[model samples]
Target: MEINLKNIFIAFLKISTILLGGGYVIIPIAQSELVEKRNWVTKEEILDYYSIAQCLGGIIAVNMAILIGCKLKGTKGALTSVLGMSLPPFLIIVLIANLIEKIVQIPNIDSFFWGVNLAVVILIYLAVKEVFLYALKDILSVFWFVLILVLACLKVNPVVLILSSLAFGLILARFKKEVKDE
Candidate 1:
């Protein structure tokens, strides 16, 4: 099915507006909308876009929306999706920034934010699990996950950690290909 630019923009607007917690909260929603509802992208493609987004420097959701849009309907889709995703939040934050600061000073508001924070953590965990299930298909991927987790826990520089992991994965993949060719 041909995905229209208007539909892509509307999808981003809906996701950005309704998703309560943050980027993490948007994952399942995006997956359901893009993969299940619209059938614009597959689950595996979404996961791949997510991985690429993470490895690059930017907001994951915006990057993902742009990538998915570009994949579907080229440059126009990318621009509309990004605008849809960004404009509402930017305007709302600007309007409410002062009010939010004042509200944050209130005890109940603090508690509310705390709850939201916890929900964000849970959302991230679930999103990560979903991504892992989609992306990690073999023992080598599992090993790389463990290695990165350990390194991150040890406070390793993230850039180095990511580069090293990529290098290791490439080397292992190359070695596997050679062995298969023999």
Candidate 2:
């Protein structure tokens, strides 16, 4: 598998320049650029990365950077992508940090952020819809999806949900095999 660190850096840099809002908002953007445009990874692959990102508990975009970067060009690629995605934001944050308190009081700033937040919500929704469509590949998957959705709505612990899903899948696979062999 050939991978170029430069391309990885360039792609992530382009992505970061336009990114805004919470890290979750990066999902659709990353999908558009990495999976759809660059074809560096598949939709499923990126979704998997996103899921892993959730489990890992850092900024979603940064976790995604590491995953996509490693997938594209190993460790060096990961480093390049991380730097590309982080550098500008880091600089901007440093510049803004001292002034953020004052900026928050600016007229219409709250409303502007409110609009941006709504757009980010839409972006996150679209990304989840795409991932759900891809993941609903079979009856078993559908069952788990619905089950997890209900459990999540009920506020079940995520760790338990993950474990339950793993058990369900494993049992289903075994049952299918047993029936097939009979």
Candidate 3:
């Protein structure tokens, strides 16, 4: 089925509305809506796109939305999905910023935010578990995970790490191809 801009817009609206902890929390929701319900991409494909989104220089949620949109309908779909995903949060932040000074004085608002934080923690935990379960598919992947984790702990710049990982992967692929041809 052909994807319309309206469809992409609506999909992002649904995804963005329920999202509290940001892009990471969107995984389960995206899996259900985009993969299972809409069949825009498979579980594995979405995960791959999520990884790619993470390595790039933008908000993961926007990147994921664009990747999924592009997968579904190309350039127009990508722009439409980004527009859909961004507007709600932008508007929300604007509204929230306007109210922050007054709202911070209320005890109940603090409690509400604390509750939201707890919920976000849980959602993030589930998303991480799901990602690890799928991502650690082999010894090589495990090795890379450890290496990346260590790098992160050492305070390596994320952009540097991403570029290094890309270079490493390309070199490994090239070496493997050459070895196979030998």
| Candidate-wise lDDT, in order | 0.78, 0.82, 0.82
Task: Give lDDT tens digits, candidate 3, residues 88-144.
Answer: 888988889878888889879778878987887877676667667677767887898
Candidate 2 error regions (>4 Å)? 1-3, 166-182
Model 1 global lDDT (CA atoms, 0 to 1): 0.78
Taking all chains together, the TM-score of candidate 1 against the true structure is 0.81
Candidate 1 per-residue C-alpha lDDT over 1-182 given as tens digits, one digit per residue, 9 for 90 to 100: 45787788888888888677666676777777788888888777877787677677888888988898899878998998998899789999999887986866777876787798888787777667767765566676677788888989999997898778668768888766642210
Q: Find the 10 residues in a row with the least total lDDT in model 1.
A: 173-182
Where in model 1 is the C-alpha error above 4 Å? 18-22, 173-182
**Candidate achieving higher lDDT, 1 or 3:** 3
Error of 2 at 165 (Å): 3.4
Clashes of each: 0, 0, 0
